[model samples]
Target: MNYDRILAARTSRIKASAIRELLKLAANPDLISLGGGLPSPESFPLDLVMELTEKVINKYGSAALQYDTTEGFTPLRKALVEYINAKGIDAGLENIYITSGSQGFLDAIGKLLITPGDYVAVEGPTYLAALQAFNAYEVHYAQMQVDKEGVIPESMEEIIQSYPVKFVYTVPTFQNPSGKTIGVQRREKIAEIILKHDVLLIEDDPYSALRYKGEELPTIKSMAPDNVIYASTFSKIFAPGLRIGFFVAPEKLGRWLVLIKQGVDLNTCTFTQALATEYLTGGYVSKQVQKNINLYRPKLETMLKELEDNFPKDFKWCEPDGGMFLWVEGPEGMDMEKVYKRAIEKGVGFVPGTFFFPNPGDGIETMRLNFTNIAEEQIKQAIKILASVVEEEMKITSIN
Candidate 1:
């Protein structure tokens, strides 16, 4: 009955997510958690979803409940084609495919392309879930340097030059963990670099629609359509429970991903896709996104103000244009993990940033905080508690 011997060798590389475990601690009702990147429950259009449910069942009838193609629900794919085209990426029905969520594409891409020991060039402090997905495929990461503007194009090019990377991955706009968005010029440079090297890049953009301020920037995929695979999800603007995500890729890669997905889940949930199709064609996205912006913008501003007024000057954080999270970095050799532990004891929670780095012992001075899930007053209270914990930790570090 020893399952270790019967399990696949790949199981060794797939460890439980540290953040997932941390979230459990944050689940206590008294804890004010900034640990999760969860969209606000307030952001979900609950009434509209119920309304759409009736419309979908009435419109599609038994088709809504039936099995669908491995590629995806066709109407959803067609709606997404227009959705992305508005972003300036030139794509069509053939180029569109759906998955259970963006997480599904992450795993599918890793399975479709990576061989054991193959290299993947990723931003130094990248999306932690991506590392989780690729780990199962036994892929090694070649870390890229990042600045306030997100991944440096030169750093990505250097890694690509030095390694036989299967593909390059990026979350260019309002990136998770860091809340850094690459500027348009950098996006152009990244596009040029990918084209120059003839490399494939994955542009995972789930936050662009959540813009609270500033003009919308062009996607890297728009700049290099042939070279980048663009993935997005309804989790932010819509409901996460639906678990609906989709991607646009070059025809050959798209077909291969579809083939790979067939063995995983025959198809994504048809009922949810039908609801999303109506959500799109019904023109609910713009209104829902605007409502989210109105709700989150003030929380973001409140957190920034609280940080400025309460935290030590040496402790700096990213001023993101739009995103659910903020990245805070303390002075050198200052461990945020210690601060995280202390903050939790005080009924406030945030994620230590080191786990986001593919390399161990990096980003020890950093942490990520989520603003969208908590209220403005709670944000004020949580930051005050967190700032106090950080100050105490700094004093201890200084004494040591």
Candidate 2:
């Protein structure tokens, strides 16, 4: 059918996701997968879901099933006001807008702001799906340096100074792939830099509510209200299948985002939005968050302990306070992709870290491991198996 000949030029910039392909290997029931950023089935309030649905049906009636405004369902937006305000974000209904999921906002924002050859400043090893979203618009990336604290404010300033970047994107709170939280001072510095440069920043925070051991950090959005667009999802705290995510941006930008979303999907989902409205307004969030923490904290601790006991001395990983992943870095010249293949063959799977970087050839010495989805004992088994693969790779690297 030679469809390639008729396809748009922009399609060439998009590549198949390496993590998605690797997950296929993880589908084998015997494989202990530390690959996907999936929440534990136990974390879902499945018993509460039916009750919530019934409440939605009773409360909103026909409107719950009917089409809604491009912006979002009104009651859900209203309910989120008190919800986000607690996090220190001063947002009103005008500031909040919904999308199919956070992924939808990522794609819409890319479509809204990006022109071909436009540069976006991102951390060296940033969220893989973000790069995938921006790539379709043929966007270029200006890589920013990161340490254990997530994005360095100075590196961000340097990138902004060096490149004609359209915008800056960051997953500042318990960031994906890296599980590093930017501290309050760094958040202030980042806010200062963005405001000084008069640039927009996207704060992709999907994991802040899953706190395990640290004090809650202030959001970058609160630190720089006018300069940052804050986006989050119900995937972690609630359920992923609902596909309900929302953003708080300046009213002007929010309006445009809604307009842009109109062409994509008329609205996120009326019934789901109704369900979210009830969930948020019914005081279910905190209890659910605590339940998730109780379920995941031990698994995270188990994985950390297993790594300390089993992994090679030179290998290190971020001990995050709360998040779904841990970023493990092997010594220099160690390629984690080779380790991933070996681990998969041994019935353990993880994502090779290079896939997370916007630039090719970066983060080859690393991999990302997920603890929430796997049982504690399985996490123990997977880490032990994965460590052996890593040790073997280290020995091979030493010899070669």
For model 1, state the Cα shift of residue 359 in Å.
0.3
Clashes of 1: 0
Compose the digit string of candidate 1's lDDT tens values, residues 1-400: 8967887888788756666776566677889988888999988888998899999989999999999998899999898888989989899999999999899999999999999999999997999989999999999999999998999999999999999998999998889989999999999999999999999999999899988889999999999999999999999989889999999999999999999999999999999999999999999999999999999999999999999999998888999989888999989979987888788889999989999999989999999999999899999999999988988988888933
TM-scores for the candidates: 0.98, 0.98
What are the per-model numbers of colliding residue pairs?
0, 0
lDDT of 2 at 378: 96
Computed on alpha carbons, the lDDT of every model, listed in order, comes to 0.92, 0.91
* 135: Cα error in model 1, Å: 0.4
Off by over 4 Å in 2: 17-23
The residue pairs that clash in candidate 1, if any, are none
